[model samples]
Target: MEQVPLRKIIHIDMDAFYASVEQLDNPELKGKPVAVGGNEVRGVISAASYEARKFGVRSAMSGAQAARLCADLIFVKPNFDRYKEVSKQIRKIFHEYTDLVEPLSLDEAYLDVTENKKGNPSATLIAKEIRQKIFETTGLTASAGISVNKFVAKIASDFNKPNGQKTVNPDEVEAFIEVLDVKKFYGIGKVTAEKMYQLGIYTGTDLKSKSIEYLEEHFGNSGKAYYNLSRGISFSQVKPNREMKSIGAERTFFKNLSSEIYMEERLNNIAEEIERRIKKYKIAGKTVTLKIKYSDFTLQTRSKTLPYFISDKGLIFETAKELLYQEKLKDSVRLLGISLNNLNTHQKKFVVYQLKFEF
Candidate 1:
């Protein structure tokens, strides 16, 4: 028996997730400009409602610019607990159709429905059902894109955001590629987009025209990636069941530091990075380990086990600092890493305790 190609990918993204949740809970916020993030002078916007977007407000924009864009813009800090609850709700909805779900962020995920729970094989129908369920359950709208591969599905979802969807059928992949802007392709960041524009590669057609050799000569290995994507030959699959692995971060310095104060400062940064990863996974761990690699290539590790799991940045930093202080390393350090282990799968219970203690 010939195996059927297993490629039914769909990308589902919430529309202004944080801002929409605020509006859903507060009726007065509807139709008004809302920005969800820190409002401090140095803070940047994390999510902007459609009303704010019309006035040039965007995620990562300075608070001052966002405020100037919409004098009526209201700022609301992100509530991680509530957001995590919503993410679980959406994930449960995804599980209704397929177990093959890969979450990219709290607001985005890719699902493979080649063989689905609902018994419907068409990716388009599965996306529709998922979007409808989200609106019915959370009072929020979602935009989805159905395509033959992860790359196309991801790009399709962004084409019509805010309660809309666009599908890219396998047969129409070529036309889709030809019409797409080079900047819109996946993996083409702002820096790469600018570089592509300078090289007269403004569209997918322009990118496709460049031979593999030409791209490799200029952009290295990534050049081959761009060449294939431009021809609508994206082969990336919808990866599933990606577990939350041990969270850690290591950084190398330009200069080896012998001073204790500077080493701790560097450790603080590494600790914060680990905390960010734990927060992203919505999980906490019970062990804190600090890794120090000396300038002479010698490595040292110090670990401490905590009574309770933690996801807070300050706690991780404190534990890592304690480990570093207790270690009797006399050599100068070149690199440092902070890591967490032993996840307490019961995330909500720990989260509540964390709020009471850490907050």
Candidate 2:
């Protein structure tokens, strides 16, 4: 049997990233309840500081609701360009250790440091150093979690916040997961957690007690994942420079449009954008997908796979039109998007050579 190497993974999450950045830039915002977004009735909060969180302010909550919760909540507009620059700096620091870094977002990432540049055997030490370096360089605090796999590492990262580190060793993996709440497991959202509670599976141990057949009968495909997670058996790797799964663009309108003509115009613009991105990336895809969002916030997607790969804007727009026309609109659409998938552009390019032999 082939031996599988025991990998060391680290998941790093910034401590209230946008909020922290806001506080870092302005001294006055420090030690105050801050939210990053417009403070309008319809505007939503992108992030909230720990102080604001105390008053139930949260990301994705309406500004009006946040205001009602916290009367003096401070709102700051997001600076995405500045955030991107900071993200680049953080990525640079990660690459100094290992290239096996998977960025989840601007604020979080997973790093596989099993064979790091520093020649360190201990993942714990590497995570510690990385956190320290990030703080020293970016004036931001990052929480680190080191474990044998990405799943546990991500959960452990949240164990300590605002600058902390935690390690779950190989020997302790089983015990560490057994007592954990089922809700804490990755992919187990609130709805699923409620279902789990109904089934009396509140912790890892309780989940492990249920037979695979029982889980499958209830959860379908997710049963396998839940079974594996209960045993600390996630096999997901820290993939670096993961190819773009799909290239797409979307737009949300201020008002819903019932006319197909206006939607087709929007589709043309979206297709043009997708084509430009495909050309820029030198990618050709066979699958085209059209996404529509109704005024009621319901989303629908229709897709078709062509016989051959294409990156042409005309074809993209036509295919999207075909998909859109195939199904009658259930309601007025507020958003339209176009995307391409099934790409093979990242394949290696090579020149074939013929060998001549003399006897």
| Per-residue alpha-carbon lDDT of candidate 2 for residues 162-218, written as tens digits (9 for 90 to 100) | 699889988788899999999999889999999999989999999999888889999
True-vs-predicted CA distance for residue 107, candidate 1, Å: 0.8
Q: List per-prediction Cα lDDT, in the order shown.
A: 0.82, 0.87
Candidate with the greatest lDDT versus the true structure: 2
What TM-score would you give candidate 2 relative to the actual structure? 0.82
Native-vs-model 1 lDDT? 0.82
Q: Write down the RMSD of candidate 1 (Cα, Å).
A: 11.6
Best-matching candidate per TM-score: 2
Candidate 2 yields a Cα-based lDDT of 0.87
Measured against the true structure, the TM-scores of the candidates, in listed sequence, are: 0.72, 0.82
